[model samples]
Target chain A: MADQYTIHFGILGCANIARKVSRAIKLAPNCTLSAIGSRSIEKASKFAKENEYPDSIKVYGSYDAVLDDPDVDAVYIPLPTSLHVKWAVLAAEKKKHVLLEKPVALNLKDLDIILEACENNGVQYMDATMWMHHPRTTQMRGFLSDAHRFGQLKAVHSVFSYLGGDDFLKNDIRVQPDLDALGALGDVGWYCIRAILWANDYEMPKAVTAWREPEYNEAGVILSCGASLRFEDGKQASFYCSFLSNLTMDISALGTRGNLRVHDFVIPFQENLGPFYVTANSGWVGMSIGCDPPPTEHLIKTDLPQEALMVMEFSKLVKNIKVNGVAPERKWTSISRKTQVVVDAVIASIGKGFVPIEIN
Target chain B: MADQYTIHFGILGCANIARKVSRAIKLAPNCTLSAIGSRSIEKASKFAKENEYPDSIKVYGSYDAVLDDPDVDAVYIPLPTSLHVKWAVLAAEKKKHVLLEKPVALNLKDLDIILEACENNGVQYMDATMWMHHPRTTQMRGFLSDAHRFGQLKAVHSVFSYLGGDDFLKNDIRVQPDLDALGALGDVGWYCIRAILWANDYEMPKAVTAWREPEYNEAGVILSCGASLRFEDGKQASFYCSFLSNLTMDISALGTRGNLRVHDFVIPFQENLGPFYVTANSGWVGMSIGCDPPPTEHLIKTDLPQEALMVMEFSKLVKNIKVNGVAPERKWTSISRKTQVVVDAVIASIGKGFVPIEIN
Candidate 1:
């Protein structure tokens, strides 16, 4: 199956993540970066030239042109967060498989529209939350499957924060109020919220109360936010996200027997820092240092231009669609639905002054 | 003042915590254990004898007898949680200062009765939560006062859990069906809630939601509980307490600039563990590890126990009450009112399955 088909990707943005995804597509055994698109013609031409693609690899000055390309089986949308839904719908309308960036949309309404468009067009639509596809996350789920060992899942606590420099913030969509959908929450917090929901096997929260400060450049962009979500099965997740500071990521799940915490979920094995650490039950027992593989060994390490890992996964899904004649059996629809519900709840909670919002 | 005053103590209920308090009294230079009372006369007598108290120390089977003893200036009531109201009221009626165990009562009505009794009898009534008296907690408050260094106060997370043995299950008042109180939230969660409220300077929560698991033996007793509190200031606190688990104690406050976390609020400094550890902003900066002396230190090592610090600080406000030939001030009423308001909110939240109870 791997050799029989390849996912042909059309890049929709010339951003860093998009470049990484393009490179990853080139590296993926069953994937190829078939085209490049950017708002700037020079940037699109230069990216295609640097990648040394054939003349058949289309270069477009607009996202729709890339979406309309015949050779491109799928589009990786790494545009500003605010544009995720618009491009996702456009790609879906063009019947191109889409890998939309994290958060999917600024609110539930836009997410609903994108979902509808994908359904109507019968094209695969997925929010690119790459951590959900990681082996560590899969392993964590396996460990938690034994209810007796883990006991009743009680609470989940997560944090994702990073400091940004002026250069990173200048062209960064996250800092642009009009381009960025939500600030810390839409960018990083979505990961924390999604991770908690995914780890709990897509349990939808019953209610959520969130608080956001006014430190962001825009009132709508949350500089720092905290949310408490209560689930129907009596489980809870407390999440925090911030862009007003440097990088520090942690996700902890507490149960009757003990707790499982992972530090640096998104990019566990970074150069210099080594593999991510998992502390269980106050570090009473640990696997010891150097036991896990370093980031370079385990992580997809390359200087290739491309989108984030999620984009790469979407490309894989496209390749699957091209070979199988249908989108991969919708195992992730529930996840997408749950994620959207939480995102909607967070937005509602923030608007309502941390008022409890019932997640429908 | 220390040389001139002899701190006389009368204790109700020879429970485990009561025994610890008795020992502390014995160790305190200015304090004397004048009386011990329990439902069982033999138990009270044995407890007095084991402590090697002189014959001058009285042992009473009835709580009222201990309260009526003129030699007993302060009455420590660690009776069954359900009976706390009754005994505290009786002690206050006899003009004896009252130090009651937590929850103060099964409900706010009982707490109000105790408060009224103390006010009418001109006696003090204090809920014995020693964490507030800890020096480290005071230092934490000082650190949080600098809003810029700590950033905008965001949220607080706490958990206090311990496995319950058969003895605790069989006799602990918390498991009693008729008492009608959520077990974990009432037993250990009050401390967590108190810490959250105190850290935020007694800000009343605007809303609260709670979840509780059914009891192992009694249907009414809660085996585990979790609650989310949202304050008017847009700050939030998530707390969990459980009896069906091993010990796990933590309190963490998140602010914009940094965070303040105490590993163990209760018994921070012990013989082996040295002192509680405080980590700020991910342990990157402003980390401090120090022991918190026992509450007794406030009386001997530091200044006189402020009327505000006394459990029965309100007792002095009753008619004709004279302390050192001067009328006692009414300042403690405000603090007690604030504490009651939070306690009421917690009970309401727990009863409503952690529904968002709006505070008036």
Candidate 2:
């Protein structure tokens, strides 16, 4: 029943996140899960069975087998941050399109190496930030772009935090230096940084300064942190990410003419609809006792989950490159690198005693 | 039919804010608008007529006459910032309970002078920050204090801004160096600093740092600015106040177990009720695609307006001093001084090129 345009996908890990992505691949009409691989054959087989993959899906004991599968047109790499460079580079070298998990690499240096491999192999590359593909995000963008609705942006503040309980603090790979060294900043701060950049049209900040007194685990992995970014035109953005607070994902962007607030930016409160609030040309009423027109709430409905839309979008790009003989889209790669640049600057600023790091 | 405990209030200066506070005094059950004074007798008489004050109200050509009135148990001074030290101190010295408008004084030094005058004369002193008396504010404090619902506070962010338009930027007393001097910071930022301190239970931040590139008028009065504050317990707060943006007032407080968001902190979107959002012990659900429990919106209804409540509270203090022979309430003076201390530090930080200013 598979169409000729459907991209055959291979998943290169049995991580918990892979379960969600596997479902997304199934939901995406242009993508089909062809194979899955893990270090342990039994684990891969069990994951396929538990996730209800059909008999046509292939199971392999090693990630290399998935990359080597000639039938696979693309690979979704959800391995740990430390393992991304090794598997993603190899997948790209094998001419399979790559969908890499975030904090894509430990630093920009490692990310550059992986990006270079994809460029050389002419493989489509994109990071798996699902929220970017949401229909609500597009709606919010339209408001921000309209000069009458939202004029020149003046400031943006975002917060992405959740109380990752005792078990996560002690045993999670995210808190382990060898696996996800950046910890909360990498795991949660990545989305905050990405949201800031996305709101700013991917323009890199002129400078980045990390807030002082970041909390760290015994392993020296950051448990919570915040940073401020300053753009060239005096526009500013600040974000806080933590594994020690209640669940909150908020983005408040203030412009000359309008204000936009999305309380559930990284993840919506409901799966089917995402809501955002916007107020344009708002002013005071009745001796400054109340506002004339309060912020209006707009809810966007989606037929499929945001993650599936991400997969569908990536697969469309892959199909264009494979079936139409076109080059891979460069937009995703550019924005991903820009986000990593700010992350690196924040880390650098923290390293140097909370001093501001100049961006070039 | 006036009660024996009713406090008679005389307002000094016919500033725009006085119009609202004058109405509030009439609305307050235990207060009566007995007198009003401006530099021009016609202006004072016209304001009394326009605001529909009772026939018994007195109109004086000079603020000194209002302060000199023996029947005026309390004097509300809505004079400009530069004139606050003069009129407020004189009003207190005249043995009238001093209800001064904010930026209570140009600095704590001046505020101290006014406080000493009130102390030496045995009169209550309170700033005219109306929102502080809102019933919704008390409800929010309850949430922040709940150990089970909202644990130890981690961070707070507040913003207060309004587009003052070209005429205000050019001609308003707030933008004139010799009149308001502190400009937007004194007018709008005052509320933001107070909100941050209110959220932190009035615990002062040890250090304050202003953000870079504060927009200023040609007279060198701040039009917009932001600052970050760090407390001794590692709790942090940041706020932005502007006169060049759409009207927006928001406060977000994040604790270990809960998050509190108030979209309109300075003034509610509606006059009769104020709404706030809170989420306690929230977490992800169903593959981290949505939040388990969404934030609950709480609307607090108020009988009289917040400004009227403020006048009533101030009058209660005045009557206690007059009838019950109790010492003037030090709580209002203490918090007002604390707020002034932070405001002085923010201005000092900006003066020093965005360097951190230690509170001590």
Candidate 3:
């Protein structure tokens, strides 16, 4: 008999990001990679062989085969952003826990349908934003919560950009309006928006305004964009995402008494240790030449990589429903929905001539 | 007879920032403090003594006395923004070069009067934005100008913030509407705006929009604010400044092929060596877990402090005009004017209910 605590995961595509999640599922202590489905059986078998999956792991030519397999307790959907609703809801309807990719859907409406299906089927649902599970994230939150250290939130700034080479600009699905229809706003901006919301503890901004006309491809898909968000309590946030700039990921959160900055927020240079800069109660040096007590670095270490931690967390939620007869956890779905809501508002704000868009 | 080589400096006030500039004058090879002026002669004497001015330097009770002194070749005005036009124009009318503090005036109209006086009087006018003279600044410019390394500029973001203590918020001249009335927008945002323009090679943005309602004091003085700027070429810039947040200064500039970030952009953490991060042609690691060949730190050292370099450069221009019979450099005055124009637009945008203000 299989281990009673182990939750089996079925992967639904062979996207590049799926390989990273696959490794995470294999590394997660409570999770087992049971199945992988691709359109071609040869491709699925080759992927399984190349990744060195266990002999018992099954490879299917079509995703439906994996969804029908009762042994596969959970499904990881890493298809294009446009296909998330269809694949995620279908997996939920088939009684499988769903781990959908970021840009959970093209918009909030589809994401809600996927989430509703998961809730109706009593299955766990989480968007694959691995940074949320990083130990450093929790430590940063601790600092932000410390009244003496950070005080009240004042502003948040985030950036995510990477230079898309000639081939990527010409042929990538992200540049194609029909596939990753949200483009960079959905692909990279998803993380930047999530970061702003996370910094504010998921408190929706009262209003969001896009920063004028963003650079778009010939197909009218956004390749670069920015937004400024205003919170109810006079707090503020701004973010930029682009496919035409160098790989630069940053999150800068400023509070009344302290500030925090992370250069590689989306993905750390070193997986084991993540570093961030923070300054508290800093003041000017004599004559205002420089600041006293320069910002110091705080490094957080993790036993399991953040992606593995994400997998373990999702598996625990799934195990609760399977072995303990508890209802599906709503927290994960709630956070994913909030992220999608902001993504939709950003798009809508862009659509309406970059005017301010109310969150609700 | 006087050597006629060194530019004789006459300081218009005893403000705290004046002490730093005074020291820079003393350190600059081509500049020397000749006269010190304050409303109170006793205060001028005490300032000269506390700052350890040379015995030959003169102290006067009235700022008019400094402008009237024939031996003083230039005036370093660190007075409140409200006094900039009055003192700068008067200094120019006296054939004295003006090195005025930033937010050069309350508005562009005031700045134009100052600039016109400098132009009409044939006196070199330069703002005391010292970072523009840092050797590291030149090095960063080199990278930005390199087509292979940086390519076309895409976006710029700047932040300059400090937690002004209780005493500062209560009694500082910056908080007084009749004094430095622009408050943090003029005090800190000036540098942020200048950095944005500098990163974009001095090309003014086509339009500017203030970010919602800014935090203001009871005196109707802005304490914190932000703005979004859009250029004619689809380039974007955004900046934030605050007297309420922690001491954090940053500039993140992105380009098509590369990106650059300066943690301490306004003021270097160290006086001798300034460090900045840059990445060129950086790409994703396998499965997008991380970026490869991460941003590298480049450090540039200067023999003299950036402020001292500013003094020397300004003095050199004054020497060229006085001794070499060259016309006053239009470059310095042009940059100062552009900076003021943007400041005016940002203020106008805020006043007009945060609507987009076109920059002509």
Candidate 4:
């Protein structure tokens, strides 16, 4: 049943997120879950068994074994942020394509080490930001890009937050200073920052200023924070991220002629369809007591889950590089880099007494 | 048909907003539009005819004549912001309850002058923020107040904007400093600030900071602006208001256990019903790929429009004061003062190079 065009993916770590991505790999038509590796043989074996992985799937005790597998065409790195550079670069050096988890590295300096290795090895690199592959995202982008419908962009507000509860607050790796380091900003804020960038067509803000108040945990990890981004042409954006609040993911973009809002931007409430609202050319009705046209709801249906689509898209690129001799796509790497740059700026601004940090 | 309990209202100016309030007065069961006043009898007479007012409605050549009419129980002032202190004080001095349009005055100092007059005359004072009377607002407040459902507030983000277009931007009274000195901040930002305060149960923020790069008109009046408010308990709020963007009125509030959102917070899309969304205790479904318990849309129905409800509430207070000799409700005046204080602080923050202005 195996096809030559199918890309075999080896998950580098059995992190909780890997379980979802592994399912995505299985769901993707062009990819198969070839291998999984944890720190120990027992851990890897237990994970594979618990997830009901097929007997044909390889289980390796050490990550090096996964990279050494001849059939592994791509490696999905879901290691902690501090360990990303070491493992991701090793996977690229081994001639395996890299699909790294977000907050790719602790900062840009380490991220460059990973990117340079991937480029030198002639392999595709993409961050595992699953929402980018959602069909609803593309449709929303169409609305935002329309000149007559949306007009010139003026302001955007985004929020991504969820209450992690007391157990997660105390025991989660995200709250461990040395493991994730960036904490809420790296985990949830990464999504918010990516959303703002996506809305602005990947254009970097001129400057970013963090809000004055940021809640920190005992280990000095940010639990909640927010920032405002200013553009050269007067377009503005602001985002708030927290691990101390109930689940809320929203994006509100205002344009000269229209506005768009998505309440569940990070993950759709239902996997089958994603919904958004658009109000175009609205005006006052009857002495300004009410609005003329209400925002229309748009629901985009997808046969494949967004994560599966992401895996499928990544596999297509890997297949292109292997069979057709096409160069690796650079767009994914560019977006990841820009997102990390803003993340760095926000942290820097917060560190500098809430001063505005100029984007490079 | 008028009864002793019915409150008679006099319109002090023929501003465009007055058209809406006049309809509200007529729709309110306990209120009757008794008089209309402008600079000249011709303007007042023409307005009365165009609106198809009954011949029993008095047309006053001057505002003083309406104030002199002993039958008028309350004065609804939709005059320019600059004229509020003058007319509001005069109306209050005549022992007339004042229903003033927002931004109640240019600043807190001027607003205090008007408030003091109302208090001295023992007449109720209320700002014309119609959305406060929407049934949906009361329901949303119930959710926020529920300790187990919404929990303590963490953040609030609001926006109120409309594209005023070319001619309105150039010639509208809102853009004229002499007429509405606060411009978009007073006109639209008032609602956002009020919403923020309302979400926090009228607890004022400790300090406010304006975002950098506020767009301004040629007359030095702000066309678009945003600000962040920080509370003593680490709660945060931010809002954006503009005359350069599409019609958008939104309020997103995040709490420890739940979140609340409304798209059309200022004016509902449909006149008879308003909608809001609440997602309580949401969590990950299937390895965080999607959310559990999607936000439920709540459509609050109302037989009376929000403005009419506002009129009804104002008239009820007037009737209570007139019939039962009950003291004027200080709650409305206090809320208006708090909103004005925040407005003044936002302007002060913007003026001081986007510095944080402490709210005292």
Candidate 5:
């Protein structure tokens, strides 16, 4: 095997997702966690010691220190929704590649800043939306587009909700009242919105109307919201997201001929369930549940840990960057723009008392 | 059994649905077809002769003549969509009950006229929305309202479409441009919209925005349209209807705990497809397909023919008209008002380029 291209990683946050990605980095074939950064040096050192990274791995007291590290080739940012653009741009300015967590930024303006900075620095930037990377999602897209079976797309309905932890109510930047004004939209709702846009082949919505309930601490910040999006082709999508409900996720697409539904759109592997399957003429040909071995009809199985799979994919992209200097696909830019538009509409609709807001 | 009240029936339209209902009326325990009316008397005579009604059963030369006969206690108005209110009122004034087709009228004004005539004449009136009488539908409602299953109602997404037939295009009242101008909404789409409202205990929508394809005939009428409805509690419903697509029907309700999805919400018995079942927590428990011994979990299985079921139910109501003075639950005045608001909003939105139309 051609010697695996080594990529050194710098993590900008020591939160749970960051730790999970750190472990994934260690497991990746061609990557290592070369640096760790946190607002507190003690936390950074403690994370390094607990994970047993070599003493050579640098621990930085601040994010900028890690960005300036000459040994790090790329930065993994699992920061709050608001700081995604800032740290991503800083890392790009230092010529380091970036794998930013979902949402990329709180708004389109911040996302544009990161995109321009990455372009100027000639670096690869990816929004780590692992759900799209899964093979079953691609299978779903194929099933929906197949004219012989699924026929013309009519409408899409998706829901992603979960009861969040008390820590979410703390001073954490993600739930911070002022910074992340739209809590669910910026955090979990982004995934559901992205899936709808992706399923529709990036067709921009002609109009959007939303209903939102703001959190108790911040009247300006949304806790849960549902949006109705109409596309130019007359197709429609209705999606819901919440931080106050127990975890429930599902997506159903209706077409001219038939329909396709996915019970869980995200995290197919942590499931102790059977293989997640898709059927065309026969609706929902049995999907396996909770930690069962793959059934005979199982099309795709994510036996690997989710974080590890994402890290593996990120490592491949970094290698491609080194070999070809090619930038990652620009799809993320379109997705980011659409997501911000939805977030803006949700917030605006709440202010306007849930009236339909046209997307120009 | 107290001499089952035999209701002598007269059918005004000789379409496929009319034939089905006609046969169902013959099989009903307390109903018998006494007359057949068609613009062509020869065709009406032939239909009555083939159905083997008594020789005394009249073949009316015109629909008005059938209403003029005092022997006919009820009239099944299955005529063109535009003629529903005209004949309904005429029959009611002549002291006859009415089982009007799916939509009661072209709009609320016409519906009001029909209701007023029925009230003034002391006769039973019902919009023959057959799906409501399906056993499975009642069972579905039970599951949704079950406190142990779905807790607080949250959202609803529904769709119903069917490819139009040549005959449906030729003589079907739905294609007449003016009478059925709001194409899909009045046809199959109304079922989805009504089902949502019914599931929520008739909690009307607070606002609506809709879009429709503007295909006008000489009389200037819409052929297809879709709408989004917003309810007071932040719950929402999105529905689509079209005359150009093949059959596809589904309704899903999401609640605080679990959810319910009905694959074939309408016409579940036609193709032998039992309403396929699934829940958020339980996954696909089993199929509701094929009528044999009937599954124990099955909440509704009506061996009675569709038209016969409606006739039987309506006969019971008509028999109790004097004792109960028209059961309040059987009338749809309030629901019709709410539906008309949505219909008007949809028409306005389509005309105004999908601008938001708030319901009062």
Candidate 6:
């Protein structure tokens, strides 16, 4: 047998999201949850027990212990946005391939420090944007890439919002200025920006203008905001992300020949099926009294949840590097960095009194 | 019975849209087709026969014949937008009620002329924005107005677009500089602007800025354009209209408490059933992995098409004015004027190189 049969993962911080990824790690065929760490060992052990984790996994008091352990080949960091830079760099330097949570370091400069460490040590790095690994996303990409079906994309609109109640508004780490200073723009807005960039085939916008009068908390953290992204090719995109509105995750992309809509984009309404509606080459009939045909619904079914798929993809990359002696994949790291650059630009534009800020 | 049991409609021009309105006039309980007129007698006769107008209805070679006929109580003018002021004003001066097709005139100057003639003659005037009279629209409005379900209006985004193909881009009346001069902004964007105003309880926006570098035809007529509207209350609305993209008509309104989306707002996919999806007070669970409640799809069934409902409403108003000796409804005329003012502001903004134009 090889040095390690399964890619073992050590998770940093027993954050709420860690529980879901813990299950995903167990579900992924070639991934195993080896150890978990929190500031308090009891909390980590309690999380494992509550989530019905097997007794084989180890629990530690400090994140350093998990990164220090020789048996841990990779680390999943779901720590608050503030701690991402310190721990992600340390994990990568320790030769552990890292799957870090997003708003991956608040800004590109801090994220580049971690990326540099990963490059120096030769460790795979991927952000925890689970939906990117979903098979339905692949299908949507196919439609977008087809010239006959979608033609030249003219516009894209994305929205990710959730109604945060009194308790969440007052106490969640997401709203804390120190923990996640970008606030809603960092949390849900990350998805909106990523979706826009994804639809544009990763070509960043020329400029971004944040919409006016954003709601904010007492600490001046953004509660809700929107922005318009201008592309050089004459196509356009806009997005709104809020902690003040009802939950709606939607992406509407319009091309010359077609348009596509996904109402429940971030998370599907059902566990196994993700549905998107697309219409191509639609022409008017009956003298525009009614549309000739309705948008056709395409349903994509997945055996494993998107998070598990994400874990599997990350594990495959780690396996290729650890087993086949291949270099770490830079595509994931590059996309994550580009997404953060746009996010930073949006924040800067808002700070400049909602003026359009040129993206570098 | 009353002196004139039914409001007799005289339709000027044999435009393709007139066929749909012809059916609407026949279907409306209080309305009847009385006269049909065109530039040529042969065309008018062909239209009357093709649409199956009753034998008692008169067919005329010139538009003056319809206005001259004392039996024709009202006139429905479906002519080129550039010609709206002349025909609509003439119809009103002849003491015939007017139902004008949209993009009411080239600008407010022309529209006000028609309005003045109607007021001077004590005749009812209404723009033919068919969706305004849809029962489904009323139901959706109720939801938008509810504080518990949908709270204070925050933002609205509307889109109405259709791929015009080679022929439409080359030769359609919409692309002609002197015909529908505003092009897509006038023909399709009128609906989008009206929708934003409708959602805001008809409150006028404070400022409007056209989106960057609108696509235009060779004659300098807009093929597509988008705009951002700023309201005094910090609310924002945006709209995109195009003759260069696929068929899509959507109105997505966001509020403090909830949000609503109607895919086909201008015209429903199904004539009898108008389905709108709305989500109110949605909360999250499983650490953002899932949303607790999915949006509910509300299907509103109407016995008569939206156009017919529009005709029925117009006939009822005309009946009250002519037979009951009541005053004309100021509400319809006022809303139409407000809509036209916004349309003019959008065009002005585009003309000023996409600068923010203040609304009067």
lDDT of 1 by residue, B1-360 (tens): 223255578889887667656665654555567889888899998988876777988999978788778877888887777787778877877878777777677766777888888778867566777556545556678767866556556667787766566777755767775663547767777777777777778777777666443234555577666776777545667777767654456676666555555544654323112123232343221111111110111111223222123332332332124446444444444455566676577667666765567777
The lowest-lDDT stretch of 10 consecutive residues in candidate 2 chain B is B228-237
In model 4, what lDDT does residue B80 have?
91
In model 2, which regions exceed 4 Å deviation?
Answer: none
Give lDDT: candidate 4, residue A277.
91
| Model 3 C-alpha lDDT per residue in residues B172-281, reported as the tens digit of each score | 99988998888999999999999999999999999999999799888889899999999977899999999999888899999888888898888887878788989888
* Model 2 agreement with the true structure over B262-300: per-residue lDDT tens digits: 999888889889999999988778777778688899999
Top-scoring candidate (lDDT):
4
lDDT tens readout by residue for model 3, A1-360: 349789999999888788899999988999899999998999999889888888899999999999999999999998888888888889999999999988788888888899899989999999899999999999999999989989999999999998887788767978887778898988899999999999999898999899897988888889999999999878999999999888888999999999999988888877787889898988777787777677889999988889999999999999999999989888888888888888888899889988899977
True contacts kept of each: 0.06, 0.71, 0.75, 0.90, 0.06, 0.63
Better structure of 4 and 5 per DockQ: 4
| TM-score pick, better of 2 and 6 | 2
- Which order, best to worst by lDDT? 4, 2, 3, 6, 5, 1
How far residue A109's Cα lies from its native spot in candidate 2, in Å, is: 1.1
- The TM-scores of all predictions, comma-separated, are 0.73, 0.98, 0.98, 0.99, 0.83, 0.96
TM-score (chain B) for candidate 2 is 0.99
TM-score of chain A of each: 0.85, 0.99, 0.98, 0.99, 0.87, 0.98
Those runs of model 4 whose alpha carbons end farther than 4 Å from true positions after fitting are none
Regions of candidate 6 where Cα sits further than 4 Å from its true position: A1-3, B1-3
lDDT by residue for model 1 (A254-329), tens: 6665555555566543311212222223221111101111111123333321223445566666666676666553
* Candidate 5: tens digits of C-alpha lDDT, residues A1-360: 225478888999787667667867776677888899999999999988877778988999999999989988899998876777778988999999888887677677778899899878878777777677666776778877889767777677787765455676555565676666557777778888887888788787776777433334444455567777778656768787766543556676766655666656655423322234333443211110011111112446555545566667777777787777767656655676677777777667767976677888
**lDDT of candidate 3 at residue A310, scale 0 to 100:** 96
Ranked by DockQ, top first: 4, 2, 3, 6, 5, 1
Q: Interface RMSDs of all predictions? A: 13.6, 1.1, 1.3, 0.8, 14.3, 1.7
